[model samples]
Target: MDLPVTVGIDGSESSLAAADWAAREALLRDRPLRVLHALPLMPHLLPARAAGGRPGGDLLHEVEHVLAMRHPDLRMRTEEAHDAAGAALLAAGEDADLLVLGARGSDGFPELRVGSTALLLAARTGCPTVVLPVEPPGPHPRDLVVVGVDARRPAEAALDFAFAAAHRYGLPLRAVHAGSVPRADLGGEAALLAGALEPWKAARPEVEVVADAESGGPGRVLVEASAKARLLVVGRRPAGPAALLGPVVHAVLHHAACPVAVVPGA
Candidate 1:
């Protein structure tokens, strides 16, 4: 059986948007879609009236109905868990081809765009995680799929994913490397970036690869590039139990104009 695309639903507009995006992605990949809801287990039982009129299960049914209406022929399933949202989604992602979540949860503060659960999963999940913002960026005709690379520690996983997405969407692939040096050093940085992408360019001859190196903070450069990108891909360093996301990944996740994909790398 093919691996399914999994998405976490919290009845928030952002999560609904994520579900919609996941549905489209599932269709593109020819895979099944799985919607998962995570609810906290209350220690004490309250009267029916004291509780909300509808149980948490109703959210799942509503989502299922919405998906059916939008994608009648798509194969989909729903699952509910009485566990922490992060833990449940992490477990579900173990057998999934891709995992998606909303940038913010229902209880999230307006100023804090990304919720804790999404951040934790992106940092720890084995599979790729795509975080969709509540208000998606414009769909520009010239939009490309962008990926950020650290030439010193290049990651093949992120480059491969970006190239595949570009090929699938018939778009160009833009590989960006940000340097802290002055503008004069950008040329050498661009060359290093090109060298890092040379192998992938050969492997995916159809994908038009553009290498760019700019002088500025890495996060700022990538976020600016995302203005005209359909999707942004970045790598997460795997440090075992001591793993922590770099500043660039954190900034991109919180501020990128389009959906962000975090791929684990060595």
Candidate 2:
């Protein structure tokens, strides 16, 4: 069977927002939506009740009902996992097309930063993981999808995902490369960035691509662009335990205004 778009739920407002976003994505991809609730294993104590009522089962049902009401045609299912949030989500999303989670949970601070479980899952998940943030509704241009492109260790998976997403949303794709040298010194790097995107551009000629080479840190550049982007796509380096996520991806996850897609890259 085809892998579904899986979302981790914890009854938080941000988590529920993630569920809603996942439903829309599932409809767009013509895939099933799997809502997974991970209950931490208790050796001696019973499970703590979620915001609604009971622990796992009731919360799942409530989310199911909400999703059904919003997306009547979506194919949805719920599952309860007896494990840590990060472990359960990683295991359930092993074969998933995409794994989605809220940037923050109920225990999250008002600063609206990413939680530990979300960070770990994004770094370790086999499939692409999207982190959704809770923001007030406002008017903003949504015609572009921003992607952080690294010429040194470019990730084909991330580029492909960005191109496909831009094509799907009928938006332009902006490939931004950040460097420390002056803009003049970045001419060669800019050319290299364009060359890297040549195949993806040809593949989706319908999507306009703007190649930008700027002087500064990559994290700041991508985060700034994300303010007007429909989605920000970044590549996570496959590294050892200490270096799972590069500085660029880590910074963007914490500061990006829009939804962030972290794609594992070579």
Candidate 3:
């Protein structure tokens, strides 16, 4: 059985939020919190005295101490690998129920994040991902979790993951149909979105479901809604034949108030 969730911890406030959120989520699910910090073999990051003292990386040790102070109950582990951070995370995520990451890195996103670690995990990981933002969400949210759907089969998988997340946390689900442009007959689109999600909502009657449609573009609307939402879910465009990644995923990933999960195509 999968033990619990794993959070990628660094010396960042956004990463700290991920640790706290992962702790709460793991506790709620009655599972362990695996806090992992991977250090690449970069000797330049060490102090002058310790630079020549140790060949191995010690920055990751600092990460462990920081996370331990915040969450003592969480099981902390360290990995020293020369591989990329995303690959190390995937190795750790193999047995995890969920993987949590910060939206921005320690260096900061000066250019709206050209590439994102959260997006990478979503593209490759088997488990779902949760991305934390720097600030708190807006006062009132239209939905607990908003999922964006398109004219693709992976959209159905995305909806499944979104509903599953809402049900797991006893939150309401919002199905948002965001497309390139409005069709001439947009009346049936709402019904189509509802129809896609109705089966899952029916299976889990305790959770509420709402269908929302936007006539304009997807990226801006998603960013606006994400400002207040607790979580946002979108289908991952991972280099498939029909892989189509709009600007919405990048927008929401860069500025969302809460965590975002991207479900890859099955």
Q: Better model by TM-score, 1 or 3? A: 1
**Candidate 2 local lDDT, residue 222:** 92
The alpha-carbon lDDT assigned to residue 230 of candidate 3 equals: 75
Total backbone collisions, model 2: 0
The C-alpha RMSD in Å for every predicted model, in order, reads 2.5, 2.1, 3.8
Writing each residue's lDDT as its tens digit, candidate 3 over 1-266 gives: 84668887555677767777887777666677777765555666633433545433455566667657876766655555555567888887778888888776565575644236666675677667777766656577535777887633436667777877788877787777766555764667666766777677787788788777667677777777776577888876544443344567767777666678766555
CA lDDT of every candidate: 0.87, 0.86, 0.68
For model 2 the local lDDT of residue 155 reads 85
Model 2: clashing residue pairs?
A: none
Looking at model 2, residue 252 earns an lDDT score of 87
| Candidate 2 overall lDDT versus native | 0.86
Clashing pairs in 1: none
Question: What lDDT, from 0 to 1, does candidate 1 have?
Answer: 0.87
Model 1 misplaced regions, further than 4 Å: 43-54, 138-142
Top candidate on lDDT is 1
Give each model's clash number. Answer: 0, 0, 0
Candidate 1, residue 152: the lDDT equals: 70
- Winner on lDDT between 2 and 3 is 2
Give the Cα error of residue 1 in candidate 3, in Å: 1.9
